[model samples]
Target: MALFDRYLAGQLLVYFGFFSLVLVAVYWVNRAISLFDSLIAGGSSVITFLEFTALALPNVIYAVLPVSALVATLYGINRLSSDSEMVVAQTTGLSPWRLARPVLAFGLVVALMVSVLGHVLVPLSRTALAERGAELSRDVTARFLKEGEFLHPGRGVTVYVREITPQGELLGLFLQDRRNAAMRTSYTAERAILVRVDGTTRLVMFDGMAQTLQVEDRSLVTTTFQDFAYDLAGLAGGDDGARRRDPREMPTPALLRADAETQAVTRKDVAKLRSEGNVRFSEALFALGLPLLALGFLMLGGYSRFGLWRQILGAVVAAILLKMLANVTETAARDDAALWWTVYIPAILTLALGFALVWRDTRGPHLIRPRGDGAPA
Candidate 1:
């Protein structure tokens, strides 16, 4: 019995890895395209692109694990049935519940892995990723000086550049500042350059005109200047080099505790923090429930040449419905921490359904009445 359990569990683990690798590769490539564009726009090195994509991998893997588990279990079960191995085991006095023991164990293994990622790696990666993004946001040349494009890097500020010289000069630059609703300012320059002086980023606009509009009196004032210096970091608030941390970037313990400092720094209320904390655990718990759920559904069909297509389809639909339920519950929990238990409902339901399905299989095949058309006695 122990040998059989080991064999079954080993098969599941191997298949889980294969499926995870394949799926992660596909998903990661899709993510890499967007990463490439953003990294280039921010004047990041290829190394930075690789680093950002690597940081993003943990979250992608976290998302893909459940799907990989489901597919792996289904594949393992279907293969066992196709080889008549399941029939042999069952005929040798193993009931469906007994056969499911190894699958349950396999699910627990998956659950443990997911728990580690959720509690540790994912948050750390996200925090690192966010820090890198903020650092990129501080590059004035990339954020504000892109040539032949209009950019809005801050609230009520617009900048445009017609061309940029290889010698690092801006030609035909335009700037509009409307942060002060009552008084609007616009600047246009035939040539300009960026200079850093005394730990400050300054834009030197040459041969330009400054136009001010008074909204209250409908009056406009225009003045020409030989050169004008503007403090760019002040415009985008990037001078401070401070970034707000997201709740998801914090450790689970921190989120659950949600001290006054955490709340003030993250700008999230206690209820929402608690709800997010619970969600991480509940989501990790799905790793266990999902595989068992797939195994149970696949077990419903006897060995057949055509395969367990109907059961596989049913498993997919069930997984989708359960995921939808989880999302709905998560949204509700966010509204009030008192509803935090709702997030666990899907995990509970999945486990129950898995057990129920396997037990039903143990009940023997259901009998059906003969068709009336036969009219046999």
Candidate 2:
């Protein structure tokens, strides 16, 4: 019986890995293309794109685990039944409770994996991604150092560089700023340099002349200077890192704190941060219950040549409905942190219903008699 439990557990784990790989590959392709476009469009290198995508993978894998667990459970149950293994095991007088032990153990293992991701890898990766993005935003050389082409960093700004030397010097720089409707300004410089000051980007032009025209009064003013600083903070490709820290990117411990410091740093309310924190723990429950539910629903039916197609479809629907319930509960919790316990309702309900299904199917005339003079007990 111990060997039997090992076999079932091993088979499910193997299939879970297989399905997770396949699904992740499919998801990766789709995400990679979009991310590639976004990074490249932002003037990032191929290496940068790969790094960003890799950092994004933890979130993807976290979302995939639950679905993988469900598919693995249904497929394992179907295979065991189709191959007559389930029949053999039942004929040996194994109670449903006995069979459920291994399934429950496997579910707990899967749940632990989910908890690790939710608590550890996800927050770490998200923080790294955000930090990298902030660095990219301040990297003005990479963003606008393209020579011999006119570039528009914003609606009313135009930049042109004749050449970019190996020493990071920009020659023959031309900049036009017409953002103010009443006036237009043009700058021509012999050279320009990119500088960073307190997480803000600035372009300092050397030996340049500024021409300003007043649109309403048709007046012009000109100024020549040795060096001038132009702020590039709110322009295109700006850093959102300076904006505010997102509660999602914060560690679960910080979010769980929901203190004044955390709230100030994230610029979010206590309810929102607490909800995010609680959701992380609640995800484990879904991971543990979904597989059990899938197995129990499929086990409700006896063997047939046609297979358990109906039971399979029913399990899929149940999973979807449970997911919807989870969403509803999440929304309610988000509105008020006091309702944090609502997040567990879907999982608890799933586990209870799953037990009921498995117990009902393993009872009555369909089940074979046990070996030890068990008076139909």
Candidate 1 lDDT tens digits, 186-243: 9999999988887668899999999999999989999999999988776635666457
Give the clashing pairs for model 1: none
Per-residue alpha-carbon lDDT of candidate 2 for residues 4-25, written as tens digits (9 for 90 to 100): 9999999999999999999988
- In model 1, the number of clashes is 0
| TM-score of candidate 2 against the unseen true structure | 0.83
lDDT value, candidate 2, whole model = 0.85
What lDDT does each candidate get? 0.84, 0.85
The C-alpha stretches of model 1 lying farther than 4 A from their native spots are: 142-191, 196-200, 209-223, 234-237, 240-242, 367-377
RMSD of each: 4.2, 5.9
List ranges where model 2 is wrong by over 4 Å. 148-162, 172-191, 197-199, 205-228, 236-243, 364-377
